[model samples]
Target: MKTSILRWLLDPLTSLLALWLWSRDRGRRPYDAVWRLARVTRHPDELLYRVHGHRPDDPGDALP
Candidate 1:
């Protein structure tokens, strides 16, 4: 419960940050940027992946 609440709070902030950073890049697709940013999170799927295009199970998309 506590973790869920924390994630709810932080997700938006990180997403906004990712979009801002993505805007600056101008070369990356929005979904790609979100995926890159979301990779740092404990659970990317719960954040921006659903709204964006990429699925966590994509063949080569796993985080290193």
Candidate 2:
């Protein structure tokens, strides 16, 4: 079906985005990545240092 095709197409993109967000560098630990993604989406202030637009860390930014 059309939805299945769309899901297949978007799944990789979603995975890639999660990888990018969860990854600090190319050498990302898979478990850490998943945990980070979940943590950031739910309670960003708890674990995430910063997340502002395209910049993950800006000097002007402060963590909670």
Candidate 3:
């Protein structure tokens, strides 16, 4: 387990190199794309309500 954790920490060298190479080109990094996507979804409650189809007045079926 210790070895796995150490590897995970050091694994960024490869990703860093990839990002550096991508910067040389005109392509964007995967991390940036994910961050942009997350920024667009800042409202969690609104998104969840749309997904679950819940209404403000509709309390749903009450359970005993």
lDDT of 3: 0.44
Sort by TM-score, top down from the best: 1, 3, 2
Model 2 C-alpha lDDT versus the unseen true structure: 0.50
Off by over 4 Å in 3: 1-10, 28-64
Q: Compute the lDDT for candidate 1.
A: 0.56
**What TM-score goes with each of the models?**
0.36, 0.26, 0.28
Quick one: how many clashes does candidate 3 have? Answer: 0
lDDT of 1 by residue, 1-64 (tens): 6733554476766555555666777746664545356545645556644544455656577867
Best candidate according to lDDT: 1
User: Regarding lDDT, does 1 or 3 come out ahead?
Assistant: 1
In model 1, which runs have C-alpha deviations exceeding 4 angstroms? 1-10, 38-64
lDDT of 3 by residue, 1-64 (tens): 6633453376545445444555665575454443223323543444434333223355665534
Regions more than 4 Å wrong, model 2: 1-29, 50-64
lDDT of 2 by residue, 8-42 (tens): 37565544555566565555545334544544565
Better of 2 and 3 by TM-score: 3
Tell how far residue 21 is off in model 3, in angstroms. Answer: 0.3
Residue 10 alpha-carbon offset, candidate 2, angstroms: 32
